[model samples]
Target: DPVVVLDFQSLYPSMMIAYNYCYSTCLGRVDQLIEQTEFSEFGCIGLEVRKQLLYKYRNDIHISPNGVVFLKDYVRKGILPKMLDEILETRIMVKNAMKMNNKKQNPSKGLNRKLDARQLGLKMIANFTYGYTSANFSGRMPCVDVADSIVAK
Candidate 1:
């Protein structure tokens, strides 16, 4: 028999963006043990259930324990997620440009190097996000609970 390995490149970042896992999406603490049907149809298209502390200020009516709880806030999206998305998008654009430049009849090595550097920087930032979430210092709102939740997923 042969051993096999499977890996998802940039899984955390992709998961965060796909699931809308951002600080703003967390609807505060969910006090009760949520039933399956509770808020079943409340959230966005891919809504899930999870257990969390219930905070009265946010007025979280229903609950679950799937980790993330998104709000219906039209005014703003999660700051962290938005930032990640922008970085990811920018990296994609840079990569595309790099590929295009490389395919040119007389490619400019300087331009290719700059694009590669840009994507590399973006990648480094994305990879450090998990640490950033749990960092005690520097982060404006560092929460272990939130960081744990993200990793758990």
Candidate 2:
């Protein structure tokens, strides 16, 4: 028997935006010492606390279990998430244009084809953002940790 599988088209990118998982949110390596090991009692720590805590924290303090700590709130928003949001938005606009154009009486094939190409390009860019970080290239930082964290998410 054959089975049909359903998947969310923009799952990865959506998760990134939802969790604010970007390079900017990364608070770098946790310290070896624990000068202050306070639970998240009051609330999630802000950027100010992040700076203070990074100096002496044995374990990951943030709410996320993805090996990387993120800012308590999306007040500033990360660069990667912002970029991905634009790309996804553009794709949606193009897709909508293509769909609406195809349903028109005239149905301009050229416009529809152009929209389709643009949508595909945006998709490739959004999907490859994660791979770009993981690629073990000399020019890049080669952050397998960040890539692995993304997978863990």
Candidate 3:
């Protein structure tokens, strides 16, 4: 039996956008960001100069289970979220076109197939982005934190 995975919701992309998880937004782990920024997170004042930034903007940050910290979208929108949103939107548009074409008096099967393929490709791109961050074999550095958070979501 073949499996049909319906991902119209785009959960992974949505979650990443909701949490603003991106390499550009990541400010590294708390311990590395400040001498005692980790302490600040625990309610202890840090002696480091940049400690105040984390301490004050605590609510505005998203710390993954792997201890990697990222600024919320309010602080600075991440590029991944924007890119994913566009991909999903384009997929939606393509799907709509396919649907409308199917209802036409004499729909062109070839055009419908092309539109369907385009939408599937867009969905694949949207979903594979998380894999891009977690794949250890990838040429670039993989963000374990982002991958973990995406899984957790």
At residue 141, candidate 1 shows an lDDT of: 57
List, residue by residue over 1-153, the lDDT tens digit for candidate 2: 999998978777777777776666655333312232443221122222344555453243343454456553334577878899999998999999998998899999889888899999999999888787677754264555456667776
lDDT of each: 0.63, 0.65, 0.78
lDDT of 3 by residue, 40-129 (tens): 321122223366677888898988766778889989999999899899989989999998999999999999999989999999999999
Comparing 1 and 2 on TM-score, the stronger one: 2
The best candidate by lDDT is 3
Worst 10 residues of 2 by lDDT: 39-48
Per TM-score, the best of the predicted structures is: 3
Clashing pairs in 3: none
Order the candidates by TM-score, highest first: 3, 2, 1
In model 3, where do residues sit more than 4 Å from their true spots?
1-8, 30-49
The regions of model 2 sitting more than 4 angstroms off are: 1-6, 29-63
- The positional error of residue 106 in candidate 3, measured at the CA in angstroms, is 0.6
* Regions of model 1 farther than 4 Å from truth: 1-5, 29-68, 72-76
On a 0 to 100 scale, what is the lDDT of residue 35 in model 3?
A: 56
Query: What shift in Å separates residue 85 of candidate 2 from its native position after superposition?
Result: 0.6
